[model samples]
Target chain A: MKVTVRYFAQLRDAAGTGSEQVEGDFRTPADLWTHLCARHVFPLGAADLRVSVNARYVPFEAPLGEGDEVAFIPPVSGG
Target chain B: MFVLQASPLPGGADLLPPGDLACGGVVVFEGRVRDHNEGRAVTALEYEAYEALAQAEGERILAEAAQRFGPVRVAAAHRQGLLQLGEAAVVVVAASAHRQEAFAACRWVIDAIKERLPVWKREHYVDGTRAWVACGCHHHGPEAP
Candidate 1:
């Protein structure tokens, strides 16, 4: 399946871009992030991040479908 | 009014909802970009968010806040992009039939934003250095040793 991976904050800085597309057999959000951490050398652990699939916060083990929009949420610092 | 603004949050302190006989109290809170942080002379801040998720989460929080706080109407706005010192980075307002619920809702929304929202803050210091204001758990920068 083809997955679009998005980076934010430090993850974006490390990867040099905010988003990209990947083609792999990754079935879960954790799998996709682990692949990116290896490919881009992300500084944080894949398990340490929060993820949302299709604009909704979900568990790391949430299943990913083809052409899913996944977001990696960093520790929030808003008001 | 859970919105992700790309520009400055002007008049944030005055953004409130219309009051009626039903509401006896209104609470407003603004999160400003302070001039200093962590013993550093901070000049500016950069706020970034997963806009889609941020919006969805923010709206959800507003819905939940209303349900939790009896007879309260709440709204929130968070800024994105670069913000100078003293700018209103975020604003939240709650109006309720009584002071207690309004106050509680105001506090709850802001606290939840800090914890649950997907936004991240990057501190730009005056000494030509910048760092992502980490939450003590995540945010290992580009070169984490």
Candidate 2:
């Protein structure tokens, strides 16, 4: 399946782009992270990053579908 | 329920028309561009967002506040483009029949904005580096070995 991933903050800088499409057979969010970090060097730990599907936040165990919009959000300390 | 806007001039975040005398209490929180972040002098800030998602979230926040405040007036506007330190970027106002409701609803709105909104901001430092604020999701750094 192909999933669109979005990067924010330090993750964006490291990835060099805000979004990308990756080809994988992942069934969960954790599986997707393994697939991504295996290919690219994201600046943070997979556990510390947050994931969202489409526009809503999701858990690591959430299932994926083809063409789903997945976003990797790092912790923000802004006030 | 006004959402993403430009030229929210004067009174910066407090853009609502004069409040009604019947509104016994009005709670407002203006989120300004702070001077420092993680020990760096922030020269300025730029905010960008998916307008469609932002608008939807804004409306959802307002709706939730109204449900709790009983027809109270609510206005939330966030500035786009560039902003300097100490300038207002977000203005949230909640008016209700009583002070308690106004305060609680106002707090809820602001918290929700941070936790749920899709807005993204990049902080420009005086030393010439910028960092985008990674908000609203998990923050991970390498899986445990």
Candidate 2, which segments miss by more than 4 Å at Cα? A77-79, B5-22, B48-53, B68-71, B132-145
Q: Residue by residue across B3-66, what tens digits does model 1's lDDT show?
A: 8988876453346647556988888888888888768898988888898899999999999998
On lDDT, the leading prediction is: 1
- Docking tier of model 2: it is incorrect
How do the residues A1-79 of candidate 2 rate in per-residue lDDT, one tens digit apiece?
9988887667777889888989888988889999988888977997777677877667989999999988776654322
Give the interface RMSD values of the models in order: 5.9, 8.0
Model 1 CA deviation exceeding 4 Å by range: B10-14, B136-145
Collision count for each candidate, in order:
0, 12
Q: Candidate 1: deviation at residue B27, Å?
A: 0.6
Instruction: Compute the lDDT of residue B33 as modeled in candidate 2.
Output: 84
**What is the per-residue lDDT of model 2 for residues B1-145, given as tens digits with 9 covering 90 to 100?**
6567655434523455655667778888778888886678889988766455567767888888888778687877767667887877777788777888878877777777766666668989988988786553333321110
